[model samples]
Target: MKRLKAAVIGCGAIAHNCHLPGFQKNKWCDLIAVADPSTENLKKAHEKFKIEKAYTDPLEMLETERPDAVTVCSPNKYHAEQAIAALNLGCHVLCEKPLCVSMKEANAIKKAADKAGTIFMVAFSNRLYKGNIVAKKALDAGKIGEPFMIRIRFAHEGPSPGWAMSDWFYNPEKAHGGALFDMGIHAIDLAAYYFGKITHINAMVGTLAKKIAMEDNAILQFRFASGKLGYAEVGWTSKQGFAGVEINGSDGALVVDYSDSVQLVTGSTNPSGKRVIRKKVIEKNPTAGGWPIEIDHFVDAIRKNKQPEMGLQAGIDSLRVALGAYDSDKKGKTIVVG
Candidate 1:
């Protein structure tokens, strides 16, 4: 396929740092169009990326330009609607995480994708990370045995009015849930990716600090179909940045730590009870890179007429886990995840 035309649906922080620049780096992708309700953001993206078209309304861009593919970078609330619209227009879609605010919307998008015969992918960039990939390889090799248990944690300083000085990140109506929905989905999806299907979950959400309407902190405990137990703790009020996932098995364990390491430790009965023979670690970069590989993969999948590594179902499963967490959080009991 010759250079494919692409459009961006939202001009938010993730779009700026991840999707927009990532696509710009792809030689086979033409960053032709962009859409955002904010005129200022649309203008900046247009000037910076040299995109041919900019619109405050995505429908206008879709109806007028009809690009081959579109990246839905909008908030969780709009992901389903915009993606459904794009798929209905016969365009493949790469939608941002938390596929939709509800399972109904996710299913609708899935149906639309199927009916339109367009590739619909959910962008969970963590799966593209070298560290995560390495972890998967080790697990596949049985380095971590059968994945009997796991613990995942991710936290940040939380989003202000505009963490990047852009806009519209904290509003519940725009963002949907809160920290759990915003950040927890990564861990949720990754666990499913590494171990197995998530069968059930129980969680608690609370607004520990910050005068926000949504929960700034959340704790979730769940079980996967493999009979493996797992827990995830996500928060936006953390003063110290911490992010990592650890998977435990009968014979050994896999740990992905923020200190830049993916270590496989084995032999619980051995002296010292463990050892790290292979260490794969990533240093923190100020710019925080990852999207380049994601965009490259997207382009490759499109050209090859294949599904991206993270497909629509993968995205929907992740969102279901996140929603399950929310349900568990509210109901104060474990909820079964589809």
Candidate 2:
């Protein structure tokens, strides 16, 4: 097994929480460097991870280290530029979600990835969880029949305490669309990935939080190419928990409750005219280490000369869903997503 040298950019909650720890545990990776604009963040990451090479500039690290791959954990605004820079430098890049602040920038990064012949991917770690994967398997087994509606809910008490230090994530200029871009993108991508390409969207957004300028809540409805209807509700306003996703189809239904356990229903109908099925509490693994899969996947793509599972084009397609939702919110009309 070839161990790839990896560098992480934007040492914040995402870096500390997922990328660093994930890389630390992975035998296929050598966690080399980390870069952030904040000296405080860099010092903390270096100390915690015992990383020797820490810089305040990503480009500086890229030029000096020439890593085999890099993870861009920066604010939504910087995703495209930094990923493109890494790709141009002949390194595979694993970018965090939303892809970028806009579709134009998303396309730029995709083009750069294509031209450079390097792997570029967005770290959509939600799909890596056991519950999600199991749910997908059950659906494909025809347990869910023809998929119809998808109901998704992803929320947290708000950004973690670590987020206070990364205030740029809340700024409209930096984050593009607040909770919508932050938490909503994950649900959007996961839905599109399983249900198929999003063909249309209708959305409404509002800023309900006192401190945050961006929409703390959003409601979006999407039409998938496979003729599935989906609804996603997101909010930083939730005081309950993180999130969950439920898929309903004609023959049966699947519910992945992140709070409890993953459930599947099929076969005989109950009093409520719903199928009665089995539910299981598969051990809840840690989410903090999901980024390693994204890292390893990108590296494998680089080594094999193939596009990654969540390639640049997939990122672009996912971004369009959120962007279309935003457009719908602004124009108060449904938007067609290509």
Candidate 3:
């Protein structure tokens, strides 16, 4: 097998903790180059990963290395620009999610990916979770007959003082939006993945806890094209982190507590008119949260000469839903998504 030369476009936390290590672990990929404006981060990554080349400018690295694949781990504002550049350079791109800040940018990236004819995957890592996979499979297998509603909540203490590479996560201009774009994108994307395309979005976004210019918490309600109703709560200010999802169906319900396991419950009315709930742990072992699986998926798609499962359209769709939520909040009305 020919090892694909992979480059990372940012030296941030996502790049360091996820993309870089992911590339290193994949036998079919070679981590050849990395780029970031922060010399401190560049040096740290270079030393830690023992990468061959590092550049202050991503374009420069792309031009010089001409890698077979690239991961766009930059701030939200630079995702589209960097991903488009890599695609135009004939490199398969795995971009971190939220895709881009706006639909226009997302469309631009789509055009570039289409022209390049390379594997362009968005890194929506939540989809790779075992619990999510189990839920999707159960739902598809009709174990949960006619899933009617979905609820997802993802929250963590703000990104201000930790985790993120820098303060960019707190800056509206750089991060795009706040919790909605950061944590909510995952929930939005996952909702669409399970329920189908979101047709309508109504949301309330606010900066209730954090002092950031952008929203720190958001509550989003969505109606899917499949007639499924979904709701998501995302926050960067919570005493304890939380990640959980529930899908209610006619026959039963699938509940996923991402911190632990996935459960399926079926209820029926007994002869005495009392309801009986039968619960089972359909899936366990929820420790599989990382970038390696997603990265490997992208590489496998490239090698097979097939479009990635989470391709450009998925990214565009998720971004559209997110932007719709923002618009709905700003206009104080439900926004329709085509």
RMSD of every prediction = 2.8, 2.6, 1.7
Q: How many residue pairs clash in each candidate?
A: 2, 0, 0
lDDT for model 1 comes to 0.81
Give the TM-score (vs. native) of candidate 3: 0.96
| Residue-wise C-alpha lDDT for candidate 3, range 77-196, written one tens digit per residue | 999899989999999999998899988898899889889988889998888888888889999999988889999999989776878877799887889899999999999988988989
Candidate 1 lowest-lDDT run of ten: 280-289
Best by lDDT: 3
Higher-ranked by lDDT: 2 or 3: 3
Give the candidates in order of TM-score, highest first: 3, 1, 2
Give the alpha carbon lDDT tens digit for every residue of 1-338 in model 1. 78778889988788888889988888888888899989988877877777788899999999999899899988777888899999989998888888888889888988998999877777888787767777778888887667788888888878775474454467888788888888888888888888778999888999998788889988888788877788889988887754888888876777777545677776435486664454434323311335767777777788888887688888888888888787776787889985
Please, what is the whole-model Cα lDDT of each candidate in the order they appear? 0.81, 0.81, 0.89
Q: List candidate 2 segments past 4 Å from native.
A: 160-164, 267-289
Clashing residue pairs in candidate 1 are 203-329, 260-281
Listed in order, each prediction's TM-score against the native is: 0.92, 0.91, 0.96
With candidate 3 superimposed using the best TM-score fit, by how many Å does residue 302's alpha carbon deviate from the native? 0.7
Number of the predicted model whose TM-score against the real structure is largest: 3
User: Distance (Å) between predicted and true CA of 7, model 2?
Assistant: 0.9
Off by over 4 Å in 3: 268-275, 287-289
